[model samples]
Target: MEKETDSSEMFIDPVCLMKVDSGNKNLMFTHQTRTYYFCAESCRKRFAGNPDKYLSNKSPKRKGLWGRYLDRLNKTTGGKSLNCH
Candidate 1:
């Protein structure tokens, strides 16, 4: 069972910055009394795992898996460029 969505109403998914329909009942989560919509279940899970991470106004922008891996690689190499023969 799903609610009827007003096509005019849209919400931004905090985790992925994707537009979600306001009436998306399945992919919604409530935190601190506020309801949020997500583009997918994975985004919902990520938000549920750490709501504050998405809610904090001063937190660093969230990155994708490849971005995170690149950041970690940079840290491991002290920001040195990796050269392959």
Candidate 2:
């Protein structure tokens, strides 16, 4: 287990960050003591099915303008916004 402060610094799935229950352990992970939030049980399942795949995809190389935009939206929405855009 990781400290809450350390977990707070981890990356969160853009889709999950908007949900009140997004940080559930069943739908999250801790890598290097950093917590990661997932969008849903399915997303968590997918990640668990192949952690390497998702973990590898987590690198900066996989991020794009859309991701940044979504992150900005997440912050502005107060984590309550929802859009498949």
Pick the TM-score winner: 1
Q: Would you estimate the TM-scores of all the predictions?
A: 0.59, 0.41
RMSD of each: 6.4, 10.2
The numbered model that scores best in lDDT is: 1
Candidate 2: RMSD to truth: 10.2
Q: Which ten residues in a row have the lowest lDDT in candidate 2?
A: 14-23
Model 2 per-residue lDDT tens digits across residues 1-85:
7655443444456433334343366777665675567767776666666666655654777676589898898899988868769
Candidate 2 at 61: error in angstroms?
4.6
lDDT of each: 0.86, 0.63
Residue 3 lDDT in model 2?
58
Question: What is the clash count of model 1?
Answer: 0
Collision count for each candidate, in order = 0, 0
